[model samples]
Structures are given as C-alpha cells and as structure tokens.
Target chain A: MDHNWDFASVLANKTLLLIGLKNTLVLGSVCLALGLFFGLFVGAARFSGKSWLYYPATAFVELFRNTPVLVQIMWFFFAFPIIAPFKIDAFTAATLGLTLNTVAFSSEIYRAGLQSIHKGQWEAGKALGMSYWQQMRRVVLPQAVRRMLPAFMNRAVELFKMTSLASVIAYGELMYQAKVVSTISFNPIEMYTSVALIFFLVLFPATILVRRFEARDTFRR
Target chain B: MTEVLRIEGLHKSFAELEVLKGIDLSVNKGETVVLLGASGSGKSTLLRCVNFMEIPTSGRIHLEGKAIGSARNGRVAYAERELTQLRSRVGMVFQHFNLFPHMTALENVMEGPRTVLKCDSSECRRRGEKYLDKVGLGWKADAYPSQLSGGQQQRIAIARALAMEPEIMLFDEATSALDPELVGEVLETMKELAEEGMTMLIVTHELGFAYTVADKVLFLSEGSILEQGTPAEVLTYPRQDATKNFLRGHNMFRLPEPQID
Candidate 1:
C-alpha cells in the first residue's frame, strides 16, 4: 500500500531540532573533556603503585563500570538530592552521571597505555635524577599519550554517543528532542530516523579517524 | 685513589630467593671495576642496588663520601625531596640500552641535564651533541632508538649518561644485547670512558673487554662474590671453582660444553 515518508515536518521544526542538537553537542563535548581529565587522573591513581590510591581507584572504577549507566542516571537524578547535602538540576545530574560513567571505562584505556611503558624507562628517568612525577611528565606520559590516542578517541566517540542516554534524566539532549519532535509530529519513524542519521553523521568520520590513528601509531612503532 | 663508591653488606632478595648474598665492594675514583658472572649470579642486582634502582634488603652505599639512597641501618631512607638529586650523581646504562624510545638520541641525552640540572635548552642541546660526539654518535643525534642500530643506541645511552657528568657510571651488561659485530663499538666507547678516568662499574661477560679495561674484576656466583682481584688474577687465573666454571664457557650460553673425551 502506501509507503510514505515525510522528513519535512520533523526537519521543519528547526528551532526544536537546533536546540536539541546544540544541547546534545554541548553536553557531549563538555562531558568528554571532563571525562578525559577524570579518566587520566583515575588511571594515574590506579597505577600510582601506592596501595592507598590504587585500591580505592580500582573500587571506584568497579562500582561505576560494573553498573548500568541508566541506573547511575537514576541515582543522580532521583536519589542524589535525597542523600546529598545539596539540591541539583536535571542537567547537572545528567552531566555528573555521564562523566563518572565515561571516566570509569576510559581509565582502563589509560591504565593500558601506562602499563605499556617498560620499567626500564622509569628507571632510566630515575637514574637521570628525575622524580617519579618528573619521569611521568617528561618520559612516560608523552609516549603513553601517543599509544593511548586511538583508544581515547574511541572512548570519546562512545562518550558522545552515550550522551543520548542523558534524555532519561529529562535533560533534553538529542534523543529527548527527537522523542519530543516525534510526539508532536506523530512520526516516530521520521524523527527517530533523523536522530540516528545525526549520530551517524557525527560519529562515522570519528570512527575512521580513530582507525587512522591506530594505523599511524602502528606505523610509528 | 679516593673512593667514589663504597658499599658494605649489600644484600637483596626477591621473595624467598636471595639474589645478592652480602656484596661488599669499593670502587675507587677512576677505577674500572668489571663484574663477571654467569646469568642469575646477581651481578646485575649488585649494580642496580648501587643506584637505588633495587633497594638493598640491607646495606649502606656511599657516593662521594655521602651515605645516601638508603640509611645506615639497612633501612631505605627515602630521600624523597632529594632523590632526583641523588640519582643525578649515579648514571646507569642497561643491557637493552633503554633509550627513551619517543625521543631522539639528542633529546634522550638532553632530558637528564635539562630536567634535573635545569640546564637551558641551547646549552643542553650543545652538551647533548658534545656527549653524542664523545660516544661517536654525533651524526645520529636526531635518530630514534628503533631507527638506530643496537650498538648505536647503546652508545647514545652512554652519551645520555655522560651528559649528566655522573661521578660514576654503571653498565649492567650494556653490550650483552647487541649484535656480535655491534658489541665492539659499544665496548670501545666504554673503554674510551674508562681511559678518560670516568669511574665505571661494569657487569659483562666480555673477557677481553674486562682484561683490557678493568682495574678490578669481580666474579659473582649464585648471588655472591666468588672471586675478586685484578682482571689477570680473577679472569685469567681464577681461584674459585665457580669463577673457573664461568670462564671455561664464557660466551657459551644455553649449552653444555662438548665432552672432549
């Protein structure tokens, strides 16, 4: 019978789409930056070779990583304000939940990069009279960054995609906007299709870039 | 000669395995002390302990009359604030060369001086070049470790250490990992360093390198000093059975000697 597709109505709601797109991009980018920094710090803490730091960091990673992100979103949005000493908003809840979630997974990537370093490199730096921090800053991290790049970028893409889950907290990211647009337009297929298309448009080149990074790093080796 | 490095009762054990059985030794200023041993004899461990790379289970190490890196009562005194300062005085070259892979030969040499000494960039670069040239690697200053030959990489490592102008140099079988033909070049660089009156403690199996360059030779067997004397005395005319056995098959690794009946 009639296989009719109308993207016109959904796409015509330019303001709604723009707001959603902007929020999604903003949330994704901000959380990504925060996640990367958090991941590196947590990763460093885990491998700091000190039992005090390592155990807690490992526990923290396990707590977040082993749980579903949606549960974390529930925790931040619903449970946090009840248990916490302060009030919060949906956006803050989404950001906090997403940041912690991203940090948990990416820290493993960071740990892998850090572990790839030879013990001799640390000793060489030490013998040259550099402190542990100095060795890390001067010798270890530079090499680790190169090795960690593709994984880190992959994680970043994942982070951006994961921001779609922020809609669960009523934070009004892309997926939320798409849901709203579909509800208003009575066109689930069209609105959702647009949403999927937007994600593909943003993340496909990113995947290719990650692969290129993997290739370049291999060639560098 | 004044003592550059003096160690007393240096002992180290990995779990239940005692890798160093109370090594007592003194290296005089400008003395080239070669540690000769078969694999697992703890020669590398002894060399490592001197620089606090491996904390001695018990010992005192004195560098230039300063008892540092560990306390007198075998307790590790964390010179946490001054560890970098302590490390600056002891330079070590590894069997694998361990040149910072991401950096150029020149940058690897430059790192210690620039970071620890706070040497200015141009000055560090100039000194890096000078030391690279000293080790006959002036032309390869820009090459990465993977790009350079093993011998060339080891030479750059030597240059990296020398750039710091360390009071004593430690070579933990620096030539052991090199290609056979490549071994000579690194040995020659080390020999030149010895002649220039740089105090050296070398762990090596190259008997000829030991005979030619060592003022003192120590033979380690099963984590203890089995023999110690002049190279002619320890290498050529070894007194201990362990030293004799080690010398009989110096380069014959991983094989029983053919029974010449």
Candidate 2:
C-alpha cells in the first residue's frame, strides 16, 4: 500500500474551518445556557410531590431521553417544518433538538443533586421561618449545586460533541464543513483528521477539569 | 402569669396509627415544662404540634392568645405563610442539632434574622454575635458545623434558634444525640437559658436536669398525659404506676440534685 500524506490542502482551508469552529461554539454555548437555566425548573417539577407538576415533567424527560438525538434533530429539520408555525431553518432545528436533549439529561442530574440533601435541612429551614422558595434558594441549592458541578461539566462536554451531529442536516458546523472540504479536495483522510484534532483540542481541557472536580468531591465525601 | 403557649384537644394521627389521642396544655411566660415518657410516648409529637411542624389531625394551638390555623371541616387548615410566621415565634431545637453544614456558626446564627426578619447584614451579625456569646461559643463563630464537636454544634443550634428572639423554645431531646461527656456542656447551656427566664418546653430522659430546672413536669403514657405536677411530686412520688415503672426503668426514682456552678 503506497500512500503519501499531504497537509497543504487542509491547511489552505483554515479560514473555512475557523468559521465552522465559530458556529460550533455559538451553538454549543447557547444550548448549554438555555438548557441549564430551564433544567432547574424541570428538575424541581419532577422532584415535586404534586402530581400535576410531576407527571408533565416526567413525560417531557422520558420523551427526550428515550429517543435518539439524531432522530430528534432530523424530526425538527425534515418533519417539523410542515407543521411548524414558523420557518424552521437548519440552525433553529439543530438548536431545538440539542437544547431539549441537554435539558432532559441535565435535569436528572439536578434532581439527583437536590435529592442528595437530607430532609433535615428543609426542616431546619422551615423551623427558622423560611418560606419554601427561601429554603430552596438559600439552604438547599447552595449545597446541591456543589455536588452537581462535575455532572454539569460532563454534560457540557457531551453537548459540544452532540453539536457535530448537526452535519446530517447540512448545518455547516465543524463536521459539516469537513464534509464539504473533503468532497472538494478529494482528501477525506486529511480533512477528517483535522476535524478530529480540532474536537480533541477543545474538549480535552474540559474533561480534565471535570475529573478534578470529581476528585475533590470524592475527597470531601 | 401570662400564657405564652396553649394547646387544646391536640390530636395527631399518622394514617391508622394515632400518636396523640387528646392533649391539653399551657405554658406561662418564663415557665419551663419538662416532658418525660418512654420512647413510644407522644412527647415529641406534642412539641411539634406547637410550631405547626406536625399539623394536628384535629385540634387548636395558640401562641400568645392567637389561634394558629383556621378550622376546616373537622381538621385544622394551615396556610404556609402563617406557619412560617408561627415557626419564627416558636423556635425548636431538634435531637440531631440540624445546623447548616455549609454555613459558619455565625452565619448559621444570623440566617434567621437575615432571611426571616429581613434585618440588615450588620444588625444580623450583631445579633448573631450576641447569641453565640450567650451560648459560650463566641470564639468559634468562624468554624463550620462539621469542624465543631457535637456539643458545640448543639450550642450553635441553640444560638441559631435564639437569634430569632422567639417567644418560646421547644427542646425535643436536644441533648440525646450528644456524647456522654459532651452532654454536660449542652445541658449547662440549657440551664443558663432556663435561669434567664426563657419560656421553654423540654422533652428529655435526664431526670436530673428536670429535677433541677423544670417548673412543672408531665409524664406521658401511650398518647395521653398520665400525671402532671411539680418535679418533686411527679419524679419523686408518682401516683400513676406507669410513671413509676418508667422512672424505675430509667433508674431515676430518686434523681440526685444537679450541681450548678
């Protein structure tokens, strides 16, 4: 097998790759912020004893968690536009799918974190004359958030990787740009390798940070 | 003497099991009432009812002559806001000394004033320091609950309750979870509080503490008060055989007088 590695073509398309990288960051961060913000409420609903809140939250979580992420994105892109009240662009479709997916996964983390706190903490708050929201915000969340950090960092890493799946819908993210460059350059090996290297360079630091948090948590325990 | 707390026909039931059949009690201002009974007795339940921590199945509780919950059908209905207000006035110290582990001792003491009373931070801090000093824990204010001993943590919990300036304090076996050697310090703090004329309702197995500090004593059997009188009358000479048996089991038929410095 005679093969020669050529990096010139891939290096020449740095501008396009940079654009792809920018789009990936934008999508990843937006989804992360929205997902985490909404995830807290959903998690609280699921943790609530009220059937009215618990049932709907449970249904939403199960619907997203049980299905595949690729399928969710595709449904939003290909199937949703027919019934959607507004125009569903590639970015819109991808954002909706990934954000909801992250919400569903991260909500369970929040629920477990909230549940890990002893019931006595709530009783203590109540015994001090704190209202329900006051107890949750002051006493419960401060403690629970510390335990939930590593899990949330892991979710962020997973979410960044999930952004690559938007290529299936031609969203022009990193993976999608790699496909276009490879097809035109006729160098699948070089283009795909660069994409893989890009992802690794970005995510490795976050993975290390998560590991550090988990270590500290274990030691504290 | 003015009544600080009063309970009329307080009944509590958990599903099919009834904890308190019917209870009628009153605590005057600056009075210390001690409750003594076996494990299955309804002493803890009665304390919880005063703060609306355990909603009565059917009964009424009055704090300073004001009824707590509204009557709905045969049971009492509580509003969350009202319960929160009631708890602020009636502080409780639990067996486990449930201090917020994340907060420092001073912060734990300050939390009630800051959040519930909406006091300024400086004012809260001032009150926090005062109560911590009252409990003889002024030097340990910066320490967390985990760093403190069981007795020290219980003292901080007492400070936390006291910072709210409650009208009455309820102790549900407050010293039960402390180590035997550590129990002295906590009991000593409680004795100081009693000497200061704070209204208190205590549930404990320490007959010595009751003998020395209690203004009145009540012995509970099953779910009703079997005997009620002065400590000398109830602890030393009980008319009820059940109270006598419980006292004998504790080996406290004749409690030695507690030494106070």
Candidate 3:
C-alpha cells in the first residue's frame, strides 16, 4: 500500500499547536519552580540524621517515586476530589501530581549532591565558627550546587517529557491538543509525528548542553 | 604566664572504643606545644575535642579559663550554638587543608570574618590580605584551591584560619598531606607563626621541627600521655618505653644537640 505523506494539514493548525505549546511551557515551568524550591528543604530533611525528619521525608519520597506518574495524575484528578476540601480542576490535579513527582526525584539528587561533599569541609566551616546554616549556605551548597547542576538539568528534561502525561487528564497541554487535532483531522500519523518533532526540537539542545556541563571539569580538585 | 587553653580529665569514646582516656594538658599564652604519637594515639581526637568536633564523653575544656560545655551529672553537655561561638576563637588547620575549592584564596580567608563575624566586605578583604601575606600567599589570593600546589593550599588554609584571629591555633598534622619537598614550605610558615608568639597546639610527626620550635612536647600512646617535657628531655632522653619505641622509628632526622641555656 502506497501512502502520500502530506504536511499541509498539520501546518494549518499552527495556532492550535502554538496554544498547546504555551500551556505546556506554563505547566512545566510552574511545576519545576515549585518542585525545586520545595525539593531542597525536603532533601535536607531526607539528609537529616534525626529520625523525626528522616522517616517522614523518606516515606514521602518513596511513595511518590515508587508509583507511576500516570497513576498519580489519575488519582489526583479522578479519585481525589471526593475527599478534597477544594474544587480540583484538570490543571490543578496535573500540577499536584507532576510537582510532587519532581520533588521526590529532585530531592534525591539534592541529597546525593550534598552527600558527595567531604566531611572535612563541614568541619572546616565549623572550625571557622560558622553556624550549621552558614556552613551549608556558604561552604557546602556553593560546591554541592555545581555538582548538582547536571543532575538538575537532567531532571528538567525528564520533567518536560512527563508533562505529556497530563493529556490523560485532558489538561489541554501539548499532547492533549495533538490528540484532539488528530481525531478531528483523521491524520494521527502526521499529528503524532509533529508532536514528536516538536518535543525533539525543544529538548535536543538542552540535552547537549547538559552533556557539556557533565563533561567539563567544573569542580576542579 | 596566662593560660590560653586547658584540657583536664578529657575522655572521649566512640561507642565501645575509648580513643582519649582521661587526658590532661594545658597551653599558656603564646606557647607552642607539640603533640607526638602513633596513628591511634588520640592526638587528633584531643585536638578535635578542643573545638568540640569530637564531643567528649566526659571531660572539661577551658579556653582562656571559660569552660566549653556545661557539666551534666558525669557527662559534659554542649549547646551547638555555644560551640559555634567557642570554635571561632579556636582556629584549626587540617592535614588535607580543607579549603573551599570554589572560592579564591582571599574569599576562603574572608569567609570567617564575613559570615561569622558579620564584617563588611572591605573589612574582610583587609583581614584576608593581611593573613595571606602572613602565610606568604598574598600573591595567590585570587587563585582557587585547585589552582594551587598542596603546599600553597596549606598556606592558604593557614591564612583562612588566621583571618579569624583565633586566640590559639590548632594544627592537626598540617603538613602530613604535602609532598616531601612541599612539607618544608608549610612547616616554614608554621614556624614563622610560632615565632610570632601565636599560641599553638600542633599534632605532628615532624620531630626535627618539634625539637627546635616547641616550648613543650607531649608523647601520646594508646590514648594516654606517656611523656611530657621540653624537646631535650622528651626527644633526647625519653624515659618511657612507648616514647622510646615511637622515637626510634622516627629517627630519620637527627635531633639538634640540646641547647643548654
């Protein structure tokens, strides 16, 4: 069977695809900002020696990390509103699931980065009369953040891809919009191919940049 | 002479293992005391105890006559906030130098003053420059730790500690990590500090340096002090078998003839 590959239909709906792209960016940025901001504190809690902090943080991380992102999104959107105190829209549910997932994964990255620093660095700070926070802010984080950079960028890439799962909840993100356009135009192949190309175009440069960061000896000796 | 630091009945334990068993020692103002011992002899632990880096199982540490921790029943209880303030007054240099790899030499030195002392950037820079000059690393102030040699890094470490203007400096085998040739530069910097009348408690295996610079020397063995005296008495004529055995292995450098005053 010979099939003609026509690109006109896909290009004609550029406005709709553009709207989908905007929604995707908005969702991805919001979740990333909230996840990383809160992830540091949760990461510190996971790194804490005290059982009070460590146990709860461990449980939170394990629960989110062990489950699938799709299931989490479905649970938030379909099942959560019954006991929920406030109205849960598709965007809110998707944000809740994706942000927590990012938090769980990124927190581990933060924890590992902090752990990689030598104990002597902490002692050096303490010996200089720096408080615990001072040691972390001035000494530990400055060094740890550099090592954590590549890992965080990798997380951002994974997070952007995971945003597609919001389509299951009909969140009107890029993937959801693509599905609607494909069903309406009866061009599943072109619509889906266009979505793949769009993702590759956005993410390929980011991955190359992350590899460069990883390859360079940024944290010398 | 005024006493700058005093440790009395200092005991430290890691679970079932006792590393420092009821040790007692003191350093007066501007005095240089050298601690000699084998690896597990508790010299490092004793130095760490002074800064509360290794919390004492039971003991008392006095810095200029102020007790470091509150005695609770039989054990000493320390508040971390108190320890932070106490540590600022007692600088320490490690074997690995422990310089912040990300910061320049000047920034590393200025960190203590800027963050802990809450000094303005200009004031911190002045103190940073002064100490770097003292350690003979003023020219390398803009260099990162990774860019410097081990000896240069160690000198910068000394500058970083000195920037705090600590009342007494502790050197825990400060030159042990350097190359054999680089060791001399760090030791030279340390000797200059000792000569400048800076109170110092140094744990090192450099017997030659101890013989010349130390006002008092203490030999530690199996978590206890085995001998204590001038370099002449302890290095030349150690009475204990443990001290004698430790010295024999370290006879690579000849001891200078005891200067009879």
For model 1, residues B1-261, the per-residue Cα lDDT tens digits are: 799999988889999999998889999999999998889989998998888788788877888888876455637676666656777988899998888988888999998889999999999999999999898888988788888889899999999999999999999989889889999999999999999999999998789899999999998888888889998898778888877877878646644677798
Give the alpha carbon lDDT tens digit for every residue of B15-88 in model 3.
99999999999999999999999999999999999998888888899999898878777767899989999999
Off by over 4 Å in 1: B69-76, B251-261
How far residue A213's Cα lies from its native spot in candidate 2, in Å, is: 1.9
Task: Give candidate 3 regions above 4 Å deviation.
Answer: A219-221, B72-75, B252-261
Residue-pair clashes per prediction, in order, are 0, 0, 0
Candidate 3, B194: how far from true, in Å?
A: 0.9
- What's the candidate order when arranged by decreasing DockQ? 3, 1, 2
Chain A, candidate 3, TM-score of: 0.98
lDDT of 3 by residue, A1-221 (tens): 47778778899988889889889989999999999988998899988878999999999999999999999999999999999988999999999999999999999999999999999999899999999999999999988999999999999999999999999989988999999998998888989999999999999999999999999896465
Clash number for model 3? 0
The sequence of per-residue lDDT tens digits that candidate 2 reaches over residues B1-261 is 999999999899999999998999999999999999999899999988889788898888999999888887776788888999989998899999989988999999999999999999999999999999999999999988888999999999999999999999999999999899999999999999999999999999899899999999999989999999999999999999999898888883554786878
The candidate, 1 or 2, that scores higher on lDDT is 2
Per-residue C-alpha lDDT of model 2 across residues A1-221, encoded as one tens digit per residue = 46688989999998999999999999999999999989998999989878999999999999999999999999999999999888999999999999999999989999999999999899999999999999999999999998999999999999999999999999989999989998999988989999999999999999999999888843132
> Of the candidates numbered 1 and 2, which has the greater TM-score value?
2
Fnat score for model 3 = 0.84
User: Can you give the TM-score per candidate against the true fold?
Assistant: 0.94, 0.96, 0.96
